[model samples]
Target: MGKEFRCGYGKFEVKKMLKNYLLFGLVALFAGLSLRAYAADDKFYSAEQKIVELKEEFNLPSLSVAIGLNNRLAFARAVGYSDIEKDLEANTDTQYSVGSLSKPMTGLAVARLVATGKLDLRQPVSDYLERPQYTSKFSIAKLAAHTAGVPHDTPERDLAEFIDVKDHQRPMDAFYVFDKHPLLFEPGTGQHYSSNGYILLSAVIEEASSKGYVDYLSSEVWDRLGMKATELDTSFAGQESEATYYSSVNKEGLHVRSLDKRDRSFLFGGGGFISTPTDLVRMAQATYGVGYLSVEALQALSMPVKLRSGEINEEKYSLGWRVASVKLGKDDKSWLALHHGGVTDNAATAYLLVVPECKASIAFATNYVPGQFWRMRGRITSILKEYIDIQSCDRWSFAQSSVDA
Candidate 1:
């Protein structure tokens, strides 16, 4: 009556077809299991569970995480609150000031420019800055690696003065900090962690690309990687999502308050980026692409030098990354890791990037600082270790009494 619907096949034939379909699906399922047995390994999930408990104990308002294993991001999650006052939950979109984690991003830009034949690692910085009157002693490589022989700037108002002058119409206003100081060394002769040295490199990026540092990062690197939640701008100031940095009145004292957030113009290339933890994990993979630099110029980005000496100083500087060796297993050889941390009195930010033999990358970021660095380091180290091993155990202890509001 209904135009003989399904007249082409009898009921018996339809049942047989459906049975075959289910049989094929079951076969595919078993094949998938066998494939995973050889390729996939559970590495970081257990560690992540412990970390969640730790964050709750610490009373952290928010936390965002991204973990990579077996050459892919195995897990990512956002927990707690981004805005404690509003009871807003933290999510992968929550952006935190990445602080010194900005270094590797700058290095990537330099590498991309190099690939395009737009930058030369060995070229003297004077060539880009037109500071020929000064001796052409150091090269761009040293500057990127922090072995530029430059000492940290010495002035109480260095940051304050730079912040005050950044918004001016004149271009020279931002360079006032360097104009006030003298060279620390002849460049490439020694190594020291100098934020000022990095700020200078941003100037080089601008000169080479004819673009502002922020614009370059946004369009060239971050946007291209689809890192929508990450940004380098001054707009985050006084925003609800931004974490209030808390530092003790004195280094050892328990009293604390929010540190004043300065204009991004002051930090420039050295350390002025806001990102969620998920974006940062994406960044790590982009930097280490399938056993090769994504582009030819990026190859030079990994060129490292001894940045420090002695038993504790194991890291070498490679472009904008701090490269180190880590032990992951008993019979397994050590893996190369890039690490860095940022401190602005009130905020403590640390990043550990372990590129295992299997090409897995692991990264972590935390907002609160307990005022004791050694204790903080221990906790951070434990979290990383747990992720590497996939073990379940409480690594950080935040007080439940303090966490409940």
Candidate 2:
């Protein structure tokens, strides 16, 4: 259901709106709307209409979004072409590569292992394997928080090279990309975003569980959540439900050009996964609402980066998610936000936002990433907020430290 806004019935464009308008009046009636009084142009669009608008505006080949409220998937929808040239329309199950969002899965996997006493955040990761030459040692917690001083990439090796890895890069093999480089700082001394750090985390997970990264996750998380459509960003092509990846949608003369064939497994624990909006929401529920994380476990994942010098990292990053204070709706009050955004070398993008206060979570995904994904993100968020009626946050508290930290 959607909120009531002032709009003229005659001015509603049937072609642009999603679904048939056959029962628009009846639907409005149930939604507590009487469109008799307001002007035409002042009308607010529903989530469906706005999804179409965002797809068109950003030239997204395919887009999907889902909302989880009160521990259930309340809304899920997808639109546009999964393959523009093939004209394959995307459905709610279509999977798009959600880059860095893989971090939380890794984080949760670590938490699961910790719960079983198979992993320890405070221990040196070197306990699992021999420390690589030139790399300063760091604990698992620091690595997850990006405070391990791991460099993003080795010198003379741009991250794009790793991003475009076409070879079957195993999590351990991926270490060569940054293991030889020096740390950005001493471990636990500072914060720096590092995809390579996740590579290390994956290695630790592998050692602790004695299982493959995807295998461990499947058995522990996805299977438990019924997220059957989620999987690693493998090199194998032609998966039935995976959306076509596009590096660029159009050029001067060509219409749909520049496909991106990436084997993102090099960054497996950090940025290697394709998932649907529905699956992402499923993940949000398990990670935040379900009995999956104990109080202390959730505290570990949400704990803000506190440097060795005692200064809080301004990014407010935790093990796998970002912790922040967000002011929602039209109110001036602030709410706790646990969230992450994903971008895959301009090929795809995704974002998942959790408003704990409302027990509400929203996920957005697209196959083709534009230069302005946030603009599309903002528009879709506004539309979904109205659709789900998330106007305030009262069920708010950090699993870790207070906002004042």
Candidate 3:
């Protein structure tokens, strides 16, 4: 009976069903494509518009920018107030803390020592600290990568013990915290973002290379790269022309202050270095070429690490960078992009994709609200992703474009 009815059904009924199905499929396909294309085109823009929009949106009192296209300055702009209280404007000369972006410079210091055969990246921290068995498993490499099982910060017990006992006359020596606390885990077994790790490595560099962290940073990294305005600890109290940092207020606006007055002594090599945005972009570009690290060392600087979760993800820390890739598209059509961010208690900063081949680089820095440098970085990063082409910002292509044009 069923077979007979099916056979009796008109060809029109079958044709109508097929037509509806095909139409539905086509609509779904087009909708998917449209959504994807919108997401991709939605994120990119000319640098000028993005700069204008960001300043207005953030109510940035002042901002300074220097763009390197093909590793050369294609454009440089400064707008708003560097000092709102004094009615001062920020310029390329205005210095901002690159914050933990300083980590990469620390990494370069380590790499420079390695280049000169003065230190080994794989050597154990115990080799230099005189405690081989306890930290034997942790290497110089793990410290730079932040995978050495150190705490995210110096231990709280140490902070409570040390904060008031010694004032300026006593001098700052926060490295003592590591001496008091036990290792969090066996080094290299997991990855954690640790300021303490870099601090310890600072000591290690001092011991291994026989140069203090600041001296090594100057002679080997900053001065060599021609980062003239950059300094360690010199700008802690505030400067005449630099923009004062502001912390964000949850209910309304930003509360501003000076990074110079903050207790920056505790930061040491991990997060203490200060620099302007222009100086940052210049020195950072040096790492991309043979003038700095060898190609192998540069690759090592971006190598990804495994975390405690056992996931093989890209966001792992490498020498001085957080090695992660981003995609701008909803599907596989997007390009892979790399990014990193940094912050001090009074400021936040970032360095994004450098296509050394394009000779283009995108770097940014912002003053934190009165007490919110920590949160400002995430906010700034979110703001940046809205406009940045994580792939196209590469410097090499910018260079080639300059010549071709």
Candidate 4:
């Protein structure tokens, strides 16, 4: 066996070859992996460290941030507990009520439908509804843009009624809550934020597609983008992995008992979806993507409503998105950014900011309002900038133009 195992070369030659092989192995190992290892070590680790510190600094029950860079999700993380009392830790998959972020998603859907000739932005609300509740003077575009005269919320519900919702009603049920009320302002004359306006938009979606609003949105938009985790927020009991929304201020954290399980289905078109940050990022990219939404669709959704004075709506509201001009560098020219923020009184704080110039989208949600939107925005923006340099970005607001900043 020893004789059979002997090499054809002498021991000296064998040793030399073995040494050469060892050197080559070492060279390949270092040369092939060193750059990648350094890049990850510098970028990914730095981002992780900052994100962790941000959670502790804010004392949030949970925080999830996802970023799409260069047209793909490059960074995503969830920090803290999704359920603080159950001690359930939040992961990237944790679902929080996305609140008004749902509006832009609806807007994106409307854009696609318009491009495909399935829907029309200029069509009146009467054109889509089985029984048009409002005057036909206003167009679907105005409704989607929140320039429609629709009231901002259900006038039928008292504070108690709003807080104690416990039904899994149809999308049309929302109309009964506000359709009886008069318009807040003359349609297309002004901008008034209205979840009810989007409810009308949802009715339009349902009527135009001959399918339920959620069904059409899920199949056509969310499911197509691989956003399986997003869905209309309902008051069903014990939804798996749902975060308990807290409004009380406590550094230690709010308990499960203090939260209410309200139904969000009433605003399904505007502020009623539970989603993960990753899914929001996906939705943002898809909204900006040409493959999914044609150029005509993009233009239809991108036009900010101009007031009777021929000025852009003071809120800069464009379709479902609130947009602004932003510049990443002092020397850089500004570009349009599409963004929206959502807050459900006791549910969560959510924001989606899409910057097409850099092909980057940032989506973040906190289970509770952290009470420091500007601080959070700056830090999150910095983190993304550090990881991937962005020359320009679109914008989002946390509140009305004055408060949202």
Candidate of highest lDDT: 4
> Candidate 1 has what TM-score?
0.73
lDDT of 1 by residue, 1-405 (tens): 221122222244345655765575577677775644332322333444555655544544445667665445666766655543344566666667777778888887787777667887778888888653342667787677776655565563356434453432212334555545666765545667877677778878888888877778778778766667766536544264555454433564323445454555466667767776667666776555433244444344443643323212124677787765566566666555666665443554546474533344544555555444334434544545544543311111211111000
Tens-digit lDDT track of model 2 for 1-405? 111111111114435353444356557668877564221212233566666667666766677888887667777778766776676777898888888899877888888887778977777777886867533376777778888888885652344344445643457877777877777777767788988889888888888999987788999889987778888777673378888767764455223544453467667877878888888878877545437766556666656767777777757787688887666567786666778899987578999887665677789898777876777656655654653445434553545462111
What does candidate 3's lDDT look like per residue over 226-345, in tens digits? 677776544233365456766543454544454333444455567666666666666667656565776545555555544445543234666676654444435554332234556655
Worst 10 residues of 1 by lDDT: 396-405
Clashing pairs in 4: 99-271, 337-394, 337-395, 399-404
| lDDT tens digits, residue span 126-220, model 4 | 88775545648688777777777778755454332366575545568766667778898888788888887787788788888888888889888
196: Cα error in model 1, Å: 0.8
Q: lDDT scores for all predictions? A: 0.57, 0.70, 0.56, 0.71
Error of 1 at 242 (Å): 2.9
- On a 0 to 100 scale, what is the lDDT of residue 274 in model 1? 71
lDDT of 1 at 134: 43
**Global CA lDDT of candidate 4, please?**
0.71
Clashing pairs in 2: none
lDDT at 166, model 2 = 60
